[model samples]
Target chain A: MKCGLVAADGAVLHRETRPTPRVVVDARGGGRAVLEALLETVVELGQKAAADGHRVRAVGVVVPGIINAESGIVSAENLAWAGTPVLAELKAAIGDQHVILAHDVRAGGYAELRQGALIGTTNSLFLPLGTGIAAAMVVDGSLVSGDGYAGELGHTRFVNGEAAELCACGQWGCLETVASAAALARRYGVRSGRVVDGAREVLELLAQGDPDAEAVWKEALAALVDALVMYTTLVAPTRIAIGGGLVGAGETLLAPLREGVAARLTFQRKPEIVAAVLGEEAGCLGAALMAWDSITDESGEQTV
Target chain B: MKCGLVAADGAVLHRETRPTPRVVVDARGGGRAVLEALLETVVELGQKAAADGHRVRAVGVVVPGIINAESGIVSAENLAWAGTPVLAELKAAIGDQHVILAHDVRAGGYAELRQGALIGTTNSLFLPLGTGIAAAMVVDGSLVSGDGYAGELGHTRFVNGEAAELCACGQWGCLETVASAAALARRYGVRSGRVVDGAREVLELLAQGDPDAEAVWKEALAALVDALVMYTTLVAPTRIAIGGGLVGAGETLLAPLREGVAARLTFQRKPEIVAAVLGEEAGCLGAALMAWDSITDESGEQTV
Candidate 1:
């Protein structure tokens, strides 16, 4: 995989491409083996980088689940690991170089705040509504990782009528179950028994004025708007950058979302809702920035 | 009214009591008259302090509705004023003294974070559920007033069945309309035609296991839990200090509220839910702290 290092000021200092070793998944070997495989990947990557005359100052690896950055541990339910010492493992693999580990969404938020739609804004929220929904916060010119567990916006319950869908996190009628890109396709598949390629087809059908598609799209938009309004009132960010697969619908998603949020606010400042800039590379870019920031000595005292 | 200056470290250095003058309210006098009366009260208080040999370095006056603390402007729908330059007026009255104006809820949050229940916690939220809902935030050991419009949590819409109650802010089914102290009494009064005193009576009835009171209390608790979950996910605070008239219910609100939040979380860390300290004095205390902080040449970073 190609590796690039970017600073918090959006400066790309280095770019290198190297073949990453294939990850081995062993269901029978259980959690310990999964940890071993991750350690192996880090060691392999380190050796390859060193062989190519690159000093691996810091390495950031993205994973699913609750991450406690302060303790350098990761708790990913899907990854079959609880309290994995990722930072320690990476440091051991790459010798004495600095290692920065963070949640993928937060890294993405850092990228957006520095070089994306949220550029120049001290207060902003980056929401990615893909297979799952989450948010990353940048406030007062710094990414907020409160106790290393912020930005879980997807799990917010949104109760509507007696009907409720169970979320992967075991909650009923969570915003993610109703508004994520997966949710859009899931709802359609459940109704028609036809598996669609992605949420884009449903968006296309809605654009063509299909009644079912329109209804589903409206429900998703309403759910997204409900979550955004709540967030806006709580944080009052200067802007909200929306990313992930659903955002590929472009103005179709943004226009209605802006109108919905505007109609709901009375005295609160309405944040500008726009598509994110970095797209798929957001997490990588943010990780690089986080690495650089961890190594640099800068005062973090600006107001948002 | 008596005045006491409470420092951010919970030190009450100055105390004085004065008779609060009654102000005439003329609904037909227009907004300018209300502004004039408010300014007159501020000027009188400032002059009295100055006469007493107090330096009167700064004044922090709080009001409801949307407030921009940086510019010291207030816009309240209930109050007659819109875009009232409160700090400028107060500055003019107390010549050469810096003036600080802020939303009442944000002030309460500052008080809680600095000298009350949330003391010693780095990340916490101060929610005052009164006539309307608002919040003050303390993140990473500092007060967060994003663009001076943060903490309007009450206006977040909650959809339940086919029924929607219009909020005073013109939004439908706002949490404030369902869960606030005023809402509890109003809902009970409308249903039984017997006016209850406040949320305290509702709590008393709920403790005795009155079916009607239980039903309404449960609904309010659920709504509150939903909002809390949303906040918890977004900011991942270490604690939440609940204040306002409704918090006077004490354990009746805290016990069930804690259980409700615990039941909803699958993987997220459950923050401590506690009642606010400083009681009714939180706003004034926070204002005094702000005044003292403004005069101090320190970095101005909050210590708690």
Candidate 2:
């Protein structure tokens, strides 16, 4: 879990990473332990802020899940969270401070829009290709929440025919099944009959002209280009910032995507394809920024 | 060509349609004649409203085109308008009356949200499967403009493999190529070796169990189901209203869509499929409502 204390002016006062509690997720409510760990982290952070001679005005918590802003409930498959009352627990843990709960990818996109790659653009997308893929859609100057269900771009179908793979989302031939970082590594291992460390190793092997790595890389790129083209046709974004693990390949990933999307587009406006600038700290920073905005919005004060 | 004199309380005081003057869209600015026809229509409507003991405070114009809201420029292929300053011309023709320019599909959606089928829903889609297909997307309670380029759901690739046809948008197998009203008539003729009147005739043939008509209808439904599932996965709309000439088939078009979308969806939220209520008047009504809203917004008056 990444947590931080951020000032109103976008400065990080304190930063730290804590291990997320792991439990055997079954029918006996194992997710409670994870929730307890999150509560404890917030309480300790507030205490640490006081000890460091600073006052904590608000708290922003971002998680990788579907967040219901109205009821403050969260549902995450990996964390074993189903309709978990994360907001109420956090409020009880640290009383009298404004609390903001948001999706991690949306927060990261918010951070990018405010101070990173997507700055000065209204219609844009923050697409992160990690273990799983999702999107943060900034349409007409606002990050689209769609009641916390929007921006599931990876789950949309891109792969077709016999080459299509079953996605974890239970949908067939999803963009995530072919283009995600985890898919690249897994496909490389299956194709070459050799295990790789991760997509990092797959990239390295491709650099050394490995045929299996090259094939897997090409498949991922093709799926990604298809997804980008579909998004452009539907949403017409002005720019798209590619983030997460796959972007570490830099131009190896972006150049092909640019060429492929450009070649496919006929009438749609071409968007600038760029890498995300904030790295991993984006979610944490965005949470703090949102917290600050909450205060400023209520008080009508220009803080940032 | 539909024009209306609508009251602030959503009453249609007067309504009429004018023929768009035909001009050969070749060289020498043939589009200028179309622009002139539009200008004359607006001017005559304003005069009629004044003579009918009603003060014309505002005028709203809706068009099927890419509208640059900032510059008031419009580009519609059928209208032969490329970067034509429609707003400026309207303003010039109508003297000092406030003129609000908007997309026809979006205007229709706004009407539906305010007074028709999609009322009380924050996230929904107004999809009219017309001669040409486009969508009016209501995301997070606002109509997405994407600078006049959003909501081209029809243009997104859905049909694939050998059956994929070349779309007018230069893409292969767009949803519009198979699912549009024009596509239905055209495909039926090609399959059955008999020319039909339109989609209505195709629907009639399907009711009588014509094999070619059944095949074309089934194909359209399959592509539509794919497109809807993709949209539900991405945007998470709670309801979807189907309009345009194709909706005239009623349950013949809607029942299959609902069943197909339901059977396909797994982890995504399923949207209620229903026929649009306002029909042809939606766009004109929406334009009037927007015009009134603009006045009410600036004056801080509660008109509705």
Candidate 3:
């Protein structure tokens, strides 16, 4: 992805293009190959940028799954890597420069907190319901990593009925199984025997008032509301930023969801539910911020 | 309830019984009369302890609902308290002593994390499923109270088909309505016209092979497992401590619930489910710890 860095002070500086590395295919091989590949890509990009007269002080990599930021270990289920020393690899590739590795959703959440829907909000939950369900937390002006395993919202169980559908994580009735974009398509296929390509088609069908699509859409909305209600009850953040492929439904998803959650809350404060402003640029922006943080010293100020 | 505190180091302390004050009713009248009474009791107890030559440096009070520790404001639907300045009131009554106010479940969780079922575990959830469901998080030896509203687990929605039950919180199909101890009793009343006094009687009936009791019990277990499965996917805790009224069912509850959760979890690590060790005393013990922390100086050593 070719991306430009936007500083906190609204200064635009430097442009770089780097290939997103393929995630590990096998759970074995000890993550050495995957880490090596990631390092090589960053180094190549850094060299190109430097030759073009742009100084690249740091590199940021976003990965899916559990991450221990303090230990620099990535434990992503989708990736074949577990406990891979990503920080060391990035440093070895770029040589003495800073490297920041963060959970993709959390990084996205940072983008939202800084420049998007969650701006000026101290407490918020950023959940991206895509191929899977995961979330990020920004509490008291700081993102909570909790040893790099803070936000995993998708796996919470949403259904208590029989195991009609099994989640990819092997859990039955997980919120992800019912609320994600993939779940919308799967539910449609199960009910009507037509395999849709993505959640967008289902949304289009629902807009046209297709009964099957409407039913599937409502089900997914209910599931999403279930998770959000629980989150509201627990954290009661000032706002909740919904992103990822599923959120592309936009107001079609946001309006009813807000109403549903509002109907549930009585004494608890109702948080504003809004669409993410960062769009697809969230991860890259968050990476840049983290990279900036890496180079800064003890006063905790980021000078990019 | 008259209570005794056992410190983390196994030192036992006693507080003599006295009637809770009636003055709090003047500040907020009616059903909240009990809460005021409890607060008054805490103040009276603190004064008496000081008069008895015990150096009481801090006071910890645990209440139900959403609490903001930093601001000392409490909001609980069940208690009908919105923005109650509990810490201020207690501080006024108890003189210069530091007052620590915490959510009841989180306090219970603190007790478990320090000395009970969750001992030595880095990440654990303490759930007290009584009149309502609330959870406490202990991550890496620190209690996670995201703005003091981090443990409201009962509000998580539980969707099952189209027939959704309305929750007391005004939400439809909340997990508490289906899985809490009160929920079990309520289900028994609706299903078989049996007015069970509490979850204890319902469990008794289930043990006696009563079909209605068995059905309701199974439903509760399913709902609980569903919620836990979702929680595990997100936080991936090392253990989950089940406390409160429902946990009184003991092995009967823990055994089947564990099996159910394990069966549902496929890719995630299966956390051990167990009964809380501190039992009824968890809240008090936890409060004391919080009180101790409030008074302890910066060197990380306790003076009281």
Taking the tens digit of each residue's C-alpha lDDT, what string does model 1 give over A167-271? Answer: 988888888988998899989777767788879888877888877788878888988888888888778888999999989999999999999999878767789
What value does the lDDT take at residue B183 in candidate 2?
99
Could you say which candidate leads in lDDT? 2
- Which ten residues in a row are the worst by lDDT in model 1 chain A? A295-304
Model 3 DockQ class: medium
The structural similarity of chain B in model 3 to the true chain B, as TM-score, is 0.89
What clash pairs does model 1 have? none
Please identify which of the two predictions, 1 or 2, would achieve the higher DockQ against the true structure: 2
Query: For each candidate, what's the DockQ?
Result: 0.71, 0.85, 0.49
Ranking by TM-score: 2, 1, 3
Model 2 CA lDDT for position B218: 95
Interface RMSD of structure candidate 1 (Å) = 1.3
Determine the backbone clash count of candidate 1. Answer: 0
Model 3: how far residue B150 lies from native, Å? 2.9
Better of 1 and 3 by TM-score: 1
Q: What is the TM-score of chain A alone in each candidate?
A: 0.87, 0.96, 0.89
The sequence of per-residue lDDT tens digits that candidate 2 reaches over residues B1-304 is 8888888778888888888878677854678888998898888887787777777767788898889887899998878898899999887877787888999999999999999999999899999999988999999999999999999898999877788999998999999999999999999999999999999999999999999999999999999998999999999999999999999999999999999999988878889999999999999899988888778544422111
Kindly list the per-residue Cα lDDT of model 3 for residues A1-304, writing each as its tens digit: 5455444443446555655456556636535655666667676666666666656656677777777777787776556776677777776666777678888888889878877899888778888877777888776567777667667677776666564467776656777888888888888888878988888888888989999999988888887887787777766687999998878888999999999888868756689998887777787788777777666552432222
